[model samples]
Target: MADRVASDHESITTVRATLARRGSTSRPAIELPDEQSSSSPDSASSRRDADAFPAGEVVRLVVDGSERHAKIEEYAGDRSIPGAYDAPSMARDPDSASNRLVEWADDKGLELGQSVLVDVIEEGFKYGVREPGERVFYDATEAPDDSLASIAQQLEDN
Candidate 1:
């Protein structure tokens, strides 16, 4: 392997020169990344297949410090926690909040297609957090104009 550092390249060049002096006609081929993907350093995964989601469902999108937005399913849609959810007894389970929020949203007419930002700690009161709180997002559909992004933008701009 040839290093790109000037010091290493100098040594490799010297060696190749020495081989050429021996009347060797062979040449080593240098390989580089495909030109199409040179823009991104981590490009391999860019070509990988992703899970296909069902169309026409309203999906809740949560955007935070991270660039990615987590999607949560909306009404008629439900996320189930491992134990029975009572909201009053959640702090024991870190993820119990999701089940409770989905339930609460259901009762509040925020059905399957609604997107929401939920305080994981509060929802997990039955399993509340010991320290700070965690925020999770839920989405359940694919309509852009009616998506969380558009709704949030409309809300924010207004």
Candidate 2:
């Protein structure tokens, strides 16, 4: 445990030093672990186990022939809910705000009385309304300029 803590401390110091030297013309290169290495911090397993959602991140889910979006208040193991969304504005009904998953399903003509396949479009949010499965994709280029993905990218670039 002591060794692990020391390693963590060293990693933090390295990250801080890198950040502090960001603008220097001769800033030292920070070597990243190989992508093929499972032990890499950037490994898929580590990221999934880590906090998937930071503030302002929303999960987009595609279920059946429709999509939905939700804000996951917390992560519960490897579970996730997937769907679609509108940037900035969410299609919400005042009476069903607390049950947006059902609302979205109903609005999209998805029948809750039957089994459905739910695939995650992105990480960090969930609103369970179907059986969770592997990651999926949609044409995000159609997303608005003020989308969560765009905002996250901008934040990272800064």
Candidate 3:
């Protein structure tokens, strides 16, 4: 019984050490710019670019020195319209603050697809000391113009 107990303790210690090492060696998450697209023929470059940006990733936003988190939501339509591409919608965690922000924008006559600036805070940093790690600019408008398909076809022909 004593030997069995000692063995289990040793096993637990080894496992804990291994997990700690793995955690310490882990790399930070890489975020890619929205402007970069990966349609390149080289698989390695494409993979690297694709790994740079995560879909629906959560980011911190600082508005008037107040900190809030938002998610990067892709609209995926005509890129010319503001919100038709990558946009960050204010995240609603425990309340409807995001909805209120949207309403405020609407009330202000900010058209959907118009650009709005959002300050994204850095992870694990004091908000006061760190300037926004990333500035997220998204279109305020939501409607997609169907006319872009004809333009795309024209470009493909050229």
Candidate 4:
């Protein structure tokens, strides 16, 4: 446990030192763990995990179809996100707001083959990304006749 704590401390210190040393050409290279340590299996795993999400970054989910669109705003805190999406504009239409997603497999007459798209909402209270599968969008109607809803469910599971 102590060894692990020490490694964590060392990593933090190394990062801070590097950031502070940026733009200074006179300082020697700051090396915490050398190439051998960085290339180790554990170090590689740590790198992958570290790249998961950045703190305080925003993530928007846009589910769209013909003549309709739904968007939600959230912050990428630790993992994917830490809390629920706080979209105030689309809060009225619970059906169109949170439940509806793009029609990937079938249009089911709702989209009428117009197609659907989902993307990260770019600006606050504005339209977000429309590319499919970029974010999670699901429709839970218990019994939905719309083929698009079925495809959206599949997208969510995937």
lDDT of each: 0.22, 0.31, 0.26, 0.25
Clash number for each model: 24, 6, 4, 2
Tell me the TM-score of each prediction against the true structure: 0.17, 0.30, 0.29, 0.20
* Error in Å for residue 129 of model 1: 13
What does candidate 4's lDDT look like per residue over 2-109, in tens digits?
322221222221111011121243211111111222322212112222222223333233233222333222223222211112342333233344323323222233
How far off is residue 136 in model 2, in Å?
A: 8.0
**Candidate 1 per-residue lDDT over residues 54-146, each given as its tens digit:** 222222222232111222212233222221233222323325244433333334443332222211211111111010122222222233443
Q: Highest TM-score, which number?
A: 2
The parts of candidate 1 lying over 4 Å away from their true place are 1-84, 87-102, 120-158
Residue 96 in model 4: lDDT: 42
After TM-score superposition, what is the CA distance of residue 74 in candidate 1 from its true location, in Å?
Answer: 18
Comparing 2 and 3 by lDDT, which wins? Answer: 2
Q: Which candidate is the best by lDDT?
A: 2
How much does each candidate deviate from the true structure in C-alpha RMSD?
27.1, 18.8, 21.2, 21.0
Model 2: CA > 4 A from native: 1-48, 75-88, 91-100, 103-120, 124-158
lDDT of 3 at 133: 24
Give the candidates in order of lDDT, highest first.
2, 3, 4, 1
* Candidate 2 structure quality by residue, lDDT tens digits, 1-158: 13212112222111100111112432211111112222322112221233433333555543333445544322333222322344313422122234344444565454423333322222344311232222223333123445876887576556
Error of 4 at 158 (Å): 39
Pick by lDDT: 1 or 3, better one: 3
